[model samples]
Structure formats: C-alpha cells, structure tokens
Target: MIDHPPFALFIRGSKVDAFAVSDQLGFETGMEALAVSLFEDGPETMHVQALFETQAQAEACLDGLKFPSDMESFITQLPDEDWISKSQAGLPPVKAGRFWLYGTHDADNIPSNVPFPIEINAGLAFGTGHHGTTKGCLLIFDKLLESGFKPKRVLDLGCGAGVLAIAAAKALQQDILATDIDQDAVDVTLQNALANNVSEFVKSYQADGFDSPELKGQRFDLIFANILAKPLMGLAPDIAHALAPDGKVILSGILNEQAEMVSDAFTKKGLEVSPQPSLSGWTSLLGQKP
Candidate 1:
C-alpha cells in the first residue's frame, strides 16, 4: 500500500463543534478520510486531519478550502511506508494497574499468567487503553478493586470501544450496561466486547447521555464516564442520581486544568471527589456518592 502524507488543521473549540465542522465538510466530495481529535490536555481544542491517497489531491483540497480565522491548517509529508501498520505497531501493549491491554498484533506477547488481560483494536470508537483518560480510569478501577470494592451493578457511560465495560466483565464476571451517543461507537463496542470474549456480560445501547429508557430507575454500584469535561459536567446530576449508596464513579477525558471544574460539578451534586488525579495531557478524577 502506498502511503500519502496526511494533512491536518487545528481548530480552537469544543469536540462537539469540531465534529459538527467535520460533518459539514463530509458533504463535499473528494474528502476521503477525516480524523478529528480533541487535545488530550486541558483548554478544549481540536486537531483535525484529512487523509488522501495522492499528493495532488491533498494539495488541491488544502488550497481550495476556505478556512475560518480560528483554523490553522498544515500539511505533513511522511516517509513512504505502511503508515497504518506502523502506527499500530507503535501502540504496543499498555498496562494499567492489573489490566493488560493489547491489540491483535501483540496477541502472542501476552503471558498466560497476565492479570485482567484485555484485547482491543483501533476502530470506530475511542478507548483502546492508549489514551490517558482510559488508562487513568483503569488505574482508578484497580485501586477500587484493591480496596475491596465489590460492585455488583456497573455502568459504562459513553462506552467507547467498550474497553471499560469489558474490563469490568473480565475482572468481576458481572453483567455491564454500556451506552454511547453514537451508534457507530455502540457497534464498535459490541465488536470489541466479542473480541475480548466478554460479549455475554456486556450490553450496549445507543442513546443520548442519561436519556435512555433502560436507565430509568436504575442505580449502579459503579459508573464509568470517560467522555469530555463538558459532557461529564452536564451529566453530573444524572450520574449522582444513578449511583447506588456509597457508589464510586470514574470520570476521565478531562484536562488537568479542567479537573477542578469537573470535580466541583460532581461535588455540588453530592459526590465527594478524590484528590488523587492522573494525567496524560488529560486528567481523570474519581468521585464517590456519600
């Protein structure tokens, strides 16, 4: 496969707005693949990249586009190689607490004595354990497990790729309810769950945040919401109300600077935020309902 250089643009805005811009651009022809990612750290911003098969096509798209004042566009020409394979190879296996996350490419490397082994692949959704927020959540959950926290009912809100839900299933052997606003993400989660051999314990749904009928009058012993700071803040009340007494919540996908704001939102909703925070450009906070 021939590798063409990827062109990208930076936009200063929330992830929701960046996705809106991507959807608008998708309507126009010639744009093959558009990857838009929010900054891992604080200060909500987006890095949007457009992938093309040819240099001429990339230049044409870059030159013809009318960029907004807030958008900074650039083109990068990488060495000729199988970029997809190279990228996957670079991911390696990520270990957090007791959980070991590896892609199919790294399958043979996993030891038979591994604790909480999880298989994940880069697909339609996020959370392959490579992102800081995901790793942070895993570590927090491990700490909870170490402290003898036995959660019978669990919810993985915004269950991107269903990695958290899968981890819960593998570790606790309990059924999990997972949901995401995007159907593609839900699909990917299901696929990932099956790949991880936890499909029987993982139930996924596509619904707006905390608006699903399945969530009615339901409370969870533990809830994991690894979405962005804004959405996490908006879901604070729902999260607090859905938690079982003395239940814990793992919140990630936040910038270190935005951690206090998110923690305050949960705190105002009657949840006590844990001061121990993890960062990878992004931050993850652990909170519990008193």
Candidate 2:
C-alpha cells in the first residue's frame, strides 16, 4: 500500500467545479496523487485533495492554481497515519442496483440476498463503488443484465479498482479485459480481482485508452468507460471503433451539464446514445453501436 503524503492541497467547491479542478490538477499540474471526495456535511459540496512530499510543495501547488471566487483552496499538514485504510474501514457497504460493494471490514456483514458482492478497499487506485459515477455505471449494468443482455466480450476502460470488470466477470462468468492508464490502478485491480475470486476471468493491463497490444484488433460486446467528460469525448471515435456491432457502452464520470456534449461525441461516432438517470449531480450515458 502507498503511504499517504505528509501535506495536502485542498480545493473545495461545487461538485462539478471541484471535479474539473481535480482533472486540471491531475493532468496539467502533473500531481502524483489526487483524490476528490464529497464533503461529509454537504453531499453537494466536493473537495479535491492533492498530496505533496513537503509543506512548501503543497503551498506552491496551491498558489499556482487559479481558483474561482466561489471555490476555496488551502494547504494542510496531514497526520502521519494510514488514513486511506482507516477511512476505507469506516465506509459502509454500498448497494448499487443488484451489486453490493463493500470493503474488507464489511465482508461478514454482506446480506445473503445480495446478487453480486464486490470486495473493494480504498488502496492505490480508485473505484470503491462509493463514487456516483461508479454507482451509476453499476446500476446501468444491472439493468442491462435484467433486460437479458448477455455480452460475450467485455472491456472496462479506465478500470480503476476493477469493480465494473469484476462485476461483469462475476455476473456473466466470462473473461473481462480491464485496462487503466495508471500502473498502480492496474496492480490494485488485479489484486481486487484475485481477492474476489475473479482473477481468472479478469485480464488487466496498463494501457492508454483502447491503445494496447491486448486491445489491437479486438471488439467488445460491452465497454465500461467511467472516466471524465473530456476524456470520454476525446475517446468517442476510438470507443466506437472498438465496440462490436450492437455492442453497448456505459459512460460515466460526467456532470449533468456535460451530458449533452458527451452524448454528441458518441452520436457523431454513429453510436446511439441515451442518457441514464442523474445521480448526485453526475450523469451516465449508454451508447449502442450500430
């Protein structure tokens, strides 16, 4: 497990704005590790925390960013503790549609009737199924399964903790190709799949979106891309090209306001797009290839 940094730069604002800032910090600032979380007191409010090795580095990064008037930014010294594991241990089980997502602490508390129990702890990667985007994708996938949609080939692009990939493997009993741009995410995904007893069904690799030896000349019946709106839009053509005929793609990590833009990108790629229900100011889209 990666240790938490001693200092952090925090940005607090509306969920949409905070998420945008997070993307900028991750992509532009070249920050090593960043996390976005909802404020405990205000679900609508979100914060992006970027860790740093030193107090000066944290303050310097915070000073470099141009924050909106409504957004607040500051630097703080973090406690030298395994806060990631501690926070994860306190997280309650999340039931998204038919899937029950829980950390190791809740393993014994899993209900008997839960259709899919995914054990995901907060580690070096993301996607514990607590985020709205992950939950939205899971709910949509559950609905598709209920509608008798049986996909033979599945791909989980940006497969952070491999929650969606593991879910597909568990529900369909088929092999899943899970990819992530971050090597840490790939490693965590593999570990999570093994812990869930789906390691054999989940083939994970560190690859940029849809551009890897494993994905070459491959078509998937279902693809899950729970990434940000900009990346999703940029990847529309590639995503469409990689999808098999009549294949379905679940797209999330989009704010409600950005849904139409994301939908337009997929639509231009000749994929039929339908916006799923909004969850916690986020929107998920279902795209079908012709």
Quote each prediction's TM-score. 0.80, 0.85
Q: What overall lDDT, based on C-alpha atoms, would model 2 receive against the true structure?
A: 0.84
- Deviation in angstroms for 283 in model 2? 1.0
Candidate 2 lDDT over residue span 1-290, tens digit each? 44554577788888777767765565455455544333322657888777666787777667667668889877887777876665667678999888999988788999999988999876446678888899999999999999999999999998988999999999999899999887777888899999999999999998875668878889999999998899899999899999999999999999888999999999999999999999878899999998
lDDT of 1 by residue, 1-290 (tens): 44354544434444445533443343233354433233432445555445555666666766655546565556665556665666567577998888999987899999777788899865436677877789999999999999999999999998878899999999999799998877766888899889888899999998775667978789999999988788789999999999999999999877777789999999999999974565545678889998
Which candidate number maximizes lDDT?
2
Model 1 lDDT, residue 152, Cα: 95
Where in model 2 is the C-alpha error above 4 Å? 1-8, 21-44, 50-70, 78-86
Those runs of model 1 whose alpha carbons end farther than 4 Å from true positions after fitting are: 1-71, 74-80
